[model samples]
Target: MSASSQSEPRLLFISGSSREKSFNKKLAKLGENIADANGIKGTFADLGDYPMPIYNGDIEVNDGPPDNARKLKALMEVHTGIFIASPEYNASFSPLLKNAIDWVSHIKDGGLQVYRTRVFALGAASPGGMGGLRGLAQLRLVLENGLNALVLPDQFVVPKAMEAFDDNGHLKNKENQETFKAVIQKLARAAHVLHG
Candidate 1:
């Protein structure tokens, strides 16, 4: 690929939660807007749009991964980088997100091709004091060790996420906003080097 094409990162932004007004969903949207403003190609996605059954070995053995899983995998394969706004669930990432990952990983099509080939960045928003940082830590482990994916070290968290954003959906905290932007930029840089 040409240098310019390689340098331009195509990012997939996903919110792990499926609630209509989920904090993580809004956070994902903010990330998408920031990426778009910076001239990066970013696609914001909702887990609700690609629903899959809770992963089951029996189902996999009998039927195979659900069609939604295949569709999501296809969408992910085209991107050079991914950004996930995970929701905290009992100090870990949500089951909805976990199920999706499990289903996608089960696909034998390219054998972890999507995870191995792309760079990932993680962020979270929670009403608690930790700002969903705990969930992100676990998510990082899954991406790095389980999937063997390249993930950016820096992560963004929004505490009291219900009030973290402004009316326009932008982060109200300037410092936090900058940190999120930096994380996204770092992902872009890493993806370019790896996929270029």
Candidate 2:
């Protein structure tokens, strides 16, 4: 098939980091590079820009979703898949990402379940030995319940993430890069099959 005929699927990459120099952000950027190399269009969405107070149904009932929530919902609608690269805070996902998700879920004018039926892939990075695998596991369960998303079974865990990238923020670990690429490729392929 021609290159145009083989158009790649588009993914919305949600980076769960609020720090300017976050290792998880670097890992998500590396995943974007891998996605580009695999002929997938990846758009990175940083959680830092989308700030919201912790979810409170009573508060939401009084005040509506913020503008950032609307923007994220729009992006989610346009993309075929979502790839989340999260960081472990304590033993769970960063509060920033969790808040963004909460805000996105409150957009009632748009479909109640904006993420439902979408394909999702999960990954995490950390300085710890297990990376953020435990956090990603917990996140998977939450995402499944919230979105009813088609969660991919494969996941990428980048432990000692600071050491895996170079000064320019490119992933230097060949094995991890390969594994990351494979997971994203599988997500794109599955999205195509399920949504085509």
Candidate 3:
């Protein structure tokens, strides 16, 4: 790749759901489109592609980071921002998402402090009325402590997510579409400021 391409900020999109037809995945894609439209390069990181057992310090020390964990950390090092589309499991962030974060955080001298100073944004979708709002709230707290980055206050939550998408997999809800745009704009702006 050219030097310019190499220097462009890469946005990593992490989908919390592993289901084939996950609404959070759809929302993540929407966020990616918004980022691309705003001249930000976005790439999706599939959790299923990296299946590590639930995080345990003993297991990590015994086997070191799984290949997937190493690959994810490498991507995080190059990316300018992380856009997480989480699904509410029960009433909080999904275990899969938490596990991914746990693995990524464990790298860098085997501590989560490596994520400090990174930029991140959170979004969630669900069939429930709250639209995974509770989950996003908790996620913000974790990201704040772990990533040490500014997360946009305006978050996107798609209620009744199954009905929020069209046959082509594009988000159909107007309010959510606007919220997604705003969130991406804020992330891009923050990333630019931090990058400079």
> lDDT of each structure?
0.88, 0.79, 0.78
Candidate 3: clashing pairs of residues: none
Model 2 residue 171 lDDT? 68
Per-model TM-score, in order, reads 0.94, 0.90, 0.89
Could you give candidate 1's per-residue lDDT for residues 1-196 as a string of tens digits? Answer: 3223555778889999999989999999999898899988888999999988888899999998899999888888767889999999988999999999989988998648788888999999999888999999999999899999988888888999888899999999899898898888888778777885
For candidate 2, the per-residue lDDT at 79 reads: 72
| Ranking of all candidate structures by their TM-score, best first | 1, 2, 3
lDDT of 3 by residue, 1-196 (tens): 2112344566778899888888888888878877787788888877888898899889889888778888777766666677889998877899998888888887766346436645788889899988999999889988886556567687888888878888766678667677688888777667656652
Can you tell me which runs of candidate 1 are displaced by over 4 Å?
A: 1-7
Clash pairs, model 1 backbone: none
* Best-first order by lDDT: 1, 2, 3
- Per residue, candidate 2 scores C-alpha lDDT tens digits across 1-196 of 2112334567778889968988888877877777887778887888877777787887778877777778778777777778999998887888888777778876886544566756889988898899999999778877887667678999888888768778877768777778888898998888777654
Worst 10 residues of 2 by lDDT: 1-10
Q: What is the lDDT of candidate 3?
A: 0.78
Clash counts for the predictions, in order: 0, 0, 0
- Global lDDT of model 1: 0.88
Better of 1 and 3 by TM-score: 1
